[model samples]
Target chain A: MTSPQAPPALRLRRIYEVAPRDLDRAGTVSTEVRRELLALGMSPDVVRRASVVCFEGEMNMVLYSEGGRIILLVKEDRVELLFSDRGPGIADVDLASQPGYSTAPDWARELGFGAGLGITNMEQNSDLFKIRSRVGKGTVVRATILLGVPFF
Target chain B: MKLADLAGLLGAEFVTGAEHAEREVTRAFAADLLSDVLAMVQEEGVLLITGMTTPQVVRVAEVMNMGAVLFVRGKYPTQATVEYAAGAGIPLLAASRDMYETCGLLYQAGLRPAKRKGFRLDLPSGPARPAA
Candidate 1:
């Protein structure tokens, strides 16, 4: 039962904890995030991009780092996701952020991940993205997706 | 093409989501790397061609707004993965052909690439992607 309970959003916040090596339970968070976004009246385009960001962040935590938590913060103008993980932090954040530069082991590659595109994907889908990591400590990623008005 | 028609053309069978057999899907993206799928898929209702049958495949189809997934190389998903895809409402299909052949057949049938490749200025912009 370590798949992490999704507490109902008190207002516009949902938090999910991801466990390392929990490949069996991966991607559930992204699905939950998509459902919630659609329910809240967000456009499908916005929902799709946000879900991609969430899944990439979730999978990175599960496959690489020790473990981590993802927080979805929905505001009036934009939806932001906060991802923070436990150690085995990156030695160089800049190099790691580059697409196709990966340290993922062969096993992760087999499951169709660790293409070194996780960070880049998140960045591509987000209007704003930031990453900070300390070698001995951990990594924190913040991604913001701006919501546009729909002319219905 | 209709989901059912596409399945029949590939000589594939549905493992789940047969209810969506009438859904229209005109584009497809083929890859085993989930990250690549995430970065590249930009349109809604495209078909997914992959060699994997894991739950993550279904999750990607959901997240990317794909209409259905066709598994190549005779692969199949477990019950849990099928259940997840059913819940997600993304059709799942299994084909006996290898990845290369699947792509070839789909391409020959006039299915476009999943997304614009390089966004280069040299090539003519094909008819814009239809509304979702």
Candidate 2:
């Protein structure tokens, strides 16, 4: 008997590589993703939620990580975002999720980010959220926002 | 209020997106932190009032579908920032007044705070107590 064929992979509407050379270009990746989501006919509210989460993730990567990538996955019922970074991982996930905890350098603060609300904001904006990190390895953040659902 | 009327009310200069000056603004939010602004300002057509003059500010306004942005405390966006806002079709305005005074003027002009229906805080129920 022939082996069962593997199921097709989940559809990926778009993927963006967010490797900001410097802090000045940190928001570029998020901006691109937002435009793509809007063009894909995602609801405005859904796009906003995803944009906020992605923006925070992008800024964090620029300020802390050596590099990272953002993937935008669109499905019939929901939109998903994945952010993975090759950098110093979070030592304490719980502490990092706190509202006012930050390890950003002074320069990062001067650029108007690093207020320490990135992770918490991401969690609050998305309908579903998950984070994974290893001290010496890297970090990954996943956020999902369902479509056609009233956020309120 | 319309963007034009808001500009006049705050004596703001139209930095960009004059084509959208007639856009209606139903609510206002004042904050320097982008995350707070994103989390709390929930409605479309809301106006963002802030002192930060960076491209990220425009990015936030675009994502949130805000009608416009008013820079307070005489702050002005750089050329690149203005260009970005214009490209994004988000009008940018600047007033010399500080954030507090600017928000006060807008409030007096009937612009209320944006309702955050997504996140609401309620006090815990308790037994009735005597008033002090």
Candidate fnat values, all: 0.70, 0.34
Residue range A50-113, candidate 2, lDDT tens digits: 8889889888887788787888887767888999988778989988887767787786666567
lDDT of 1 by residue, B1-132 (tens): 888888888899999988888998899899999888887778888899999777888888988888899999999999999988888788899999999998898889888887755522222335687899
Q: Model 2, which residues run further than 4 Å from truth?
A: A1-11, A148-150, B118-132
Chain B structural similarity as TM-score, candidate 2: 0.88
Error of 1 at A122 (Å): 0.4
lDDT of 2: 0.83
TM-score of each: 0.89, 0.87
Worst 10 residues of 1 chain A by lDDT: A1-10
Q: Kindly list the per-residue Cα lDDT of model 2 for residues B21-90, writing each as its tens digit.
A: 8899879988887777866877788899999997889988988889899999899999988988888899
Off-target runs (Cα >4 Å) in candidate 1 are A1-11, A149-152, B117-132
Q: Candidate 1 recovers what fraction of true contacts?
A: 0.70
| Location of the lowest summed lDDT over 10 successive residues in candidate 2 chain A | A1-10
